[model samples]
Target: MHLSKLFENSNKSSPKRTGETRKLFLKKQIFCILYLEEHKTIADLCIPVGVSIPTMTRIMHELMDEGWVTELGTGESRGGRRPVYYGLNPSVRYILGIEMTRKYTRINIFNLQNKAIGDTLQIDIELDNAPGTFIELKNHINQFIKKYKLDKKNILGAGISIPGLIDKKSNISYTYPNLGQKPLDVVFGDLLKIPVYIEHDTKAMALGESWFGLARNRSNVLCLNVGYGVGLGMIMNGELYQGLSGFSGEFGHIQMIPDGELCDCGKIGCLETVASGSAIVAKAKQMIESGTNSIIRKLVGGNTEKIKLPVIIEAAHQGDQFAIELIEESGSYLARGLASLIHLLNPEMIIIGGDIAPAENLILDPIKQKLNKYTISRIRQDASIFISELKEHAVLLGTIPVVMNRIFSDEPYINNIHNFNKS
Candidate 1:
């Protein structure tokens, strides 16, 4: 499905013209440039996006008048008139980003310049109950707006990132059983009375990295989300490469040990079962249950229910032999999975994200050791592997780009900005 049609204004009475479309395209192009750079003159934007000087002037004037862009002093004159630099007026517009996982949901508010404006709120949410879940999310947004004293009019829209297969064309999440097969945007848009954008959590992370993190200039980067379940997000040729049906990055479900551990996805011996945080915790519990002497028993204080990823990481940091072994084992399995990814995608960089990345050197070292042993020397030498720069906030920061693309479509850019200002 064409993205343009999803956001097409149903009230338009006439067909769009090439000139109008070009103007709209320029608007988006300029916004992206300003977002990436702190300040840029009209001449800088014109050269890169391939627009004329007169066209840039018109677009800049419209943006400035609509309170979306601001003049940021003059630039060096190259034997000509000094060019005025312009930047996105971050305070004039805001975006709400929500990143949902099985254990919790993280929410953040960012402005046009992508600077976070308020304190991020992390809440525990149960995905099993859809109605209560959305209600809680709605309340969180309302409270956040109230806390920040933000005018609803200034909000561009909200972006929701969920783990699982997302049909971007339909905005539906197939893995979220409670959401059924309905498009998430349609449901959330109706409830919030604002344009809502939905994407796979890992894909959103990849976009986040591209826009504001280490992968900014690098294409063909792979973002691996190591959470309750491992997932992959691919950035190929400078675009988020969501495969057919938008469920491309299911690397976790890739079979590693056939007929071994059972996966929640109804698959046996999937990579996630052996490599994810849950897998580590599960292995620790099994070892403790078998009367093995380990530091995890003392760390959890004999309470199996309290065992978590952070606890295991902390124990490993404190030189707990058993905890270290568990993490190293999981890291080995993760490297085995990544080795296959290296052979297939030939990505320039591989980033490990999500909650498990905080393990830092302990997990990273084992992963690198196994990769050196398993992968071809050529691939290992070229592809750099590291933890995510955004750390735990990658998915939350990703929401800004997603919401902007959905709400600020080709036509009616000014109108949308005005609507936001008036709200």
Candidate 2:
């Protein structure tokens, strides 16, 4: 039976569906809980949904038969006989995750257990909003599916995380205003012939950190994506806070160095202009070109153009004082902007991610030093800063929750017995 049938046929209401609707709601609720918590006994599951033991046992049997749930042996016995534990069937379906940045794109397939099936395929596809960009992306997705020999029927959906201002209610990307203003999810969905969901890259990163990385179990957090351009993803009050229009965390554009440098966003002294990867590289290149004694020129083989964030970080690691100073300067400016956030949001954890994350303490130390001077001691003490452990994979892993949330929200329970009736 195709899972799409369950989602597509969920909304038809009739007197005959009264009992099925209630049952479907319960089944979905149980599925969601098990998806998050993994294996659980019928008795354990019943406590959350307020369902009777007998009723939950019956539903669990039905789910197992439907291939949506599986019995994973037994748990330790507290008394008498041991209890059986159930979890989502890992082989039942798959999810496609696509993480796009300004310079490249990555694609991978994930199973129901949130594990990647194969190596993530990365390609150089610059996201410039050209008409050919989507076509190129669609072609790669097709190739990835064919390469993996994935069953189209079993592929549940695709989740895309890209740099843009995505409107939550309309699901439209306002940043790519020149690209006909179509919702990115719709375009990808039509091309892939599967349901697709879209999310801002940094916001999705925050979701990944919240679910699988260091931000887990932490209520208030700030995920800073210190890539070519800096961006922020905020987790406020235990939820991913997407402000009105899903554009809450535009941390890069905040003014920092009054009349210092012009930003690509048509602003002067934006935080990105001073503290982003691009800014670090630009500073390194200017310093090298000025005949400063540094190993960065040798690392880039005399090509200043090749001196990117990684090269600068490598130089800093190799005891190059010039490179270290550049990173420290960037961190200093970053701390100034973050100090304001500390005073305002008072986040519990600030996660630094992206290309600069590999520098680790080199960047963190300077930011910590500056935070002391700029922020109130009491407020700044509440937020602990650290590099993201998820690093590059955060955007891809983030796609999981983005797609699942959309799936569970819109899909309802439909009485389609023929699809699942296996006697």
Candidate 3:
């Protein structure tokens, strides 16, 4: 879509040479929606939105009058009077996103600008595909909305992220049994009485990083979700790469150990067995239980059963040699898998996101070093690897784009505003 085309915003505005002017409702609507992603002044919006200063000013005024835009003070002075900037009126709309993984489920509300509101609700519930599971989740959503005092009408929609196999075509999770009986979007939409979109947890992480974090505006990136399970979200040609059945990006299942350790998928020696959060905790527990002389034992009060990924990471941070070795081992395994990815995709960037990313150099440094050893020099040089700055919030916040895109696909924002004005 050459959506960059602008239109004249006023009757007296001149026609543009290429892209449309802001005068067309469709042009102005899309441009304004893009601008809501970040604050901007009329002049700042011209080139990208393909509108002239006068046209942009007129469109901005229209949006402001409709309660979709607001003045956010002025930018730095270039010379005389500083130009006033504008941002989205966050309260005009809200989106909810829920991220469910093997270990826990996190749900939160966000504004158009991707700023989360109120404290995030995180529960230790594992994901299940049974009808009762969604019923329980729907109840939670109701309570959360009531607690926040959010009017149901103001909430536009919701986004849900889940781990494992998801068939986007049928909206059934192959990995989550009992949900294949019906289409998931319809099920959730009916329960919530609002639109709902679903995506893979790793895909949600990739979208979050692409929309609000490190991968913004970049094409051909690889986002590795390094959490309890290792997964990948591939952005190809500036879009998500979900192959047939929407079950792509299972990077962890690539065999590395060759009958090393049995995986939860019933596969032996998958990369996840050696490189994921579960692997990290399992390895730490093994070392402690086997009397490997690690401070993790002290952190867990000598109870190996109590050991978790965080305790081991803390021990590594405090200079525990055993913990450091364990992390390095996992990083090495991860690098082996990423090395394969780099050789095949040669992505512009490889982003490390999710829970364990907080460990930073403890794991990242080793992964880079292993990449240097495993990946071709030319390929490794092209892909810049880094940790996601959003940390734990990436997946939960991905709902903003998911819900917004769903709404945008159905009707133009101008029409929605027109309907809002009528009521």
Candidate 4:
């Protein structure tokens, strides 16, 4: 609620601060009031930004002139005449958020208020590690923007969330078609003709949960994006913790079974082999072929290759023992893997999202049962696992925090953000 973007250790105020500094400070204050917080009156802003009512009013008027803030209807009645509420003018800027997964690419257009502006589009395409893959993906985005009739300049930027080990400093994908280790943003941004930003899909999910869902305002939290492969995102002490190489949260590749099923990551018996959507489908196929007494066999018409996470979840919901057992088995493996995170981070909550999230309690209950059995009581007590409130949209909504964090946060002030942890 401090509202100002100044570094914590810097001088709080300078009446003599001249020219650009004063203007930038004023903009940041107005930005917090109109964008971060709900409808604000001049009085609502004074206390937080340390400005007088008159001064705040002047700054607000200036922001309005710049098309950043707009006057809404009056606030609630309080006996006296109500003050006018100021809100952010959403159309002043828009952001395109793209979430690319193994099976589909989703595009969501968001206004400055972080609210969806149009129908979310899901393009069925595989995010393959092949030549010209990014080009094809970019073309789909072009068609999407044109179909929506969006103006090029009005789009502030586009944020991409992709499945890979993305280096934060270099912005290069260590896991995909970098085409000579070039930053993906450079290649993709050139095609989009706007400033582009990219983040790991899991990290984006964690950001979405933190900003708009179950983990709102939570400092120490873990977010697991369980889809084709499992990915983990850690918010340690109030900041998203990207490891030194920005590849910290590789949840899927953790070795869970030694010398077991081979993983796409070129490893054997990784956690992904047991808990990911692909893993669930693969296991379900084997069970169907083995004459497992389950509804999934009938739902897919005995086509083992047609089995997917959704069908398995549907069969489980119908009380099919085989489907239930398979999900329980996956959850148990996931819980076993997460026990390590609980020990290392001691996070307050763990938010799970992606395709498996819709299974809700059917999938979550087993994971909790495993945690209860395996995790130390003290460590487990600190964290409560929650299904993501944003559900399948978590990855798409996550693009908001990723781009916003980079856009608004000063690099120096980012470090100044305190990490609040429990002992």
Candidate 5:
């Protein structure tokens, strides 16, 4: 299906007949239409959004009055008068995306077209300190908005993506035990005062890739996030498959060895314990402690405590034999896990994303080599594997679609605004 058509069909709903309905209603329509066909006529929008010609006419007038949309030229008619074309103004609103991982947080601002309008900020904020962590996050977002001089009223919403289990129904992150009694959205939204949306970091990345990156126009895609942990995000039949409680893609905890290395989740032989960045660093530390003597020792310069994933990747890139060995082993383990996923899902494509993907061919080559041997040749031939186009920023970009879905889906936010205006 055409990408724009998919977006438009996804938003087939009633016309919100209210003056105070969040401008997002119009914003979403404009975004969907522009993204789908680069332009749309009022009649085209009326049929898709389930509104009559008159309602669409009024909405378009309001959009123009608010400066959120503008009238382009006219479309040639089949048997009637030429119809006027409309498009999103592209300058009236923006979206902010926050990608949170176990190791770092990145914030970005984007225009209606999903183009980065300003700088992206990265910070190291540990999940262990929940209260202080979001406090710092709030400060960062406030500063970002101030720095860009963006109007909060014109901001659509902020989407936050975090690693680990997320209860989208409750807007709470269950993995951050430190947060104790509060839902993440409640806390973050109170501070931001605008709508705040939260999503599993991996799923967000998958959505990001599906909407604007490598997975575009492809259904049944698998996104692997190789970061501080390993995660999987599945897009099946052109929709994100968040099975049973929105925790489907917990690939990191999949058992690789019956009683192998221990994981922070208290499970034995979990894939992440041996394949994630943290796992790689732990294995490297253990090897160094065993007195295996290599350039990694000198790279750390006797401070074994400072060994990190990037340092190891760099060393491997620089031809450090031991580092290469570590990455190869991790890649092989990852391949074993992916082999199982391929057999079960039969995805059309598998995209490797997250921080570790930057290692590029160094890591991907081993994964491909191992999969060639592990997966059934038939399934292997059907599936193609490639690095993610959005890389580390996929989660943040994914937030755009998340918020768009929320606004356009059958939800109370838009309904309440419409109802309020009617009353």
Candidate 6:
């Protein structure tokens, strides 16, 4: 049976089905809310769900009878009877989350409760937009499902957090434009024989923060992904702000220096050129080759080619002046970019995530110190900066909301259900 049947109402006739469609829509919203934050009483659910007490109670009962929800004991009593707490049934459905970078891919299966069914599988597949890349990714995903013995019918959809310029409306990835004649999502959906939703890597991280990390319930946030390259994800007015072309958060490409190093995006002075992981490595290699003294030389056994961001961070941890200076320089450059973001957006929080996040105070202290000079005191104080605790898993966890939003966002619930059934 198609997964759409899960949302279908039993009565689908003239007067009998007058409010069935509205019930179906309400059912979708209730599921999404429960999926996001579990264990809500009927009273707790009515306001956000915009339904009355009896209506919510009836819907909750229906969802429980359908095996989508479960009663989890009772909550505190105000005066009379204690309210029953309800939540999603962990085994009712599953979601597949995939995080793909230029160098590797990670996949995991999650139940409705957002708990992993098994260990996350990491496959080393160089993502160069080659047809073979997708082929290999499909093979790995297929094998992973088999290893877990999960029924394909029970898995709702797959969410991919990939590095690319993707238009969610068109489901096309401009970065991998030559991979297929059809849209990238269609290509993957065909290969996997399931619905697939794709999102840009940085924005995916932002979604992760919104749903699972520091940005949750916050109105305005800026998530900076500082790894292989600098990337930005913005949550404005409690929504992920994908710009006119779904490319709004290209924070890395914004010009920071007038005539600095050329970025891979074919522009001069992109912020990533000076403040990203790649930039940190580039500076380290240059200085090492030029005979600058540092503990990094000892760490890498005098091989500059082996230098990377983590090594420099390690050197700084050991009190190496050169490494400390490199991080400080990058932090200062990052501050310059952030100052502009503060003045323009006035976000409530700034989350620093990705490979360089482990640098911790080494990176935070500098950015904070420099902000004092670069930003207005009141404005800077309004935006609290934090390092993401979600760490390596941020992008992966993000795919959950991306898939959920795609399923629940727009079109009439019945039409969406019918479309899924047809697909």
Q: Please provide TM-scores, in order, for all candidate models, with all chains considered together.
A: 0.87, 0.92, 0.83, 0.89, 0.85, 0.87
Please give the CA lDDT of all the candidate structures.
0.80, 0.85, 0.78, 0.81, 0.80, 0.84
lDDT per residue (tens digit) for residues 245-332 in model 2: 8988889999987877999888999999989999999888898899999999999899998998999999999999999999999899
Give me the displacement of residue 77 in model 5, in angstroms: 12
Error of 5 at 251 (Å): 1.1
392 in model 2: Cα distance from truth in Å?
Answer: 1.5
Residue 150 deviation, candidate 3, in Å? 0.6
Specify the highest-lDDT model's number. Answer: 2
Writing each residue's lDDT as its tens digit, candidate 6 over 197-284 gives 8889999999999988999879799999999888899999888998887988778888999889999889999999999999999999
How many angstroms is residue 44 displaced in model 2 relative to the true structure, after the best TM-score fit?
Answer: 1.7
Ranking by TM-score: 2, 4, 6, 1, 5, 3
- How well does candidate 2 match the true structure in TM-score terms? 0.92
Off by over 4 Å in 5: 1-31, 35-37, 41-61, 71-85, 297-302, 411-423
Q: How accurate is candidate 6 locally (lDDT)?
A: 0.84
Give the C-alpha miss distance for residue 400 in model 6, angstroms.
1.1
> Residue 381 in candidate 1 has what lDDT?
84
Off by over 4 Å in 6: 1-3, 6-26, 42-62, 77-81, 176-181, 411-423
Q: What lDDT score is found at residue 106 in candidate 1?
A: 83
Query: How many clashes does each candidate structure show, in the order listed?
Result: 2, 0, 9, 0, 1, 0
Q: What TM-score number comes out for model 4?
A: 0.89
How far is each candidate from the true structure, as Cα RMSD in Å?
Answer: 5.8, 5.1, 7.2, 4.7, 6.6, 5.3
| Model 3, C-alpha of 339: deviation from truth (Å) | 1.2
lDDT of 5 by residue, 298-401 (tens): 88888889899888888888888888988898899999999999999899999998878778888899999999999999999888899887887788899998
Distance from true location, Cα of 351 in model 4, Å: 1.6
In model 4, which residue pairs have backbone atoms overlapping below 3 Å? none
Q: Rate residue 244 of model 6 by lDDT.
A: 83
What is the RMSD of candidate 3?
A: 7.2
Task: Give the winner by TM-score.
Answer: 2
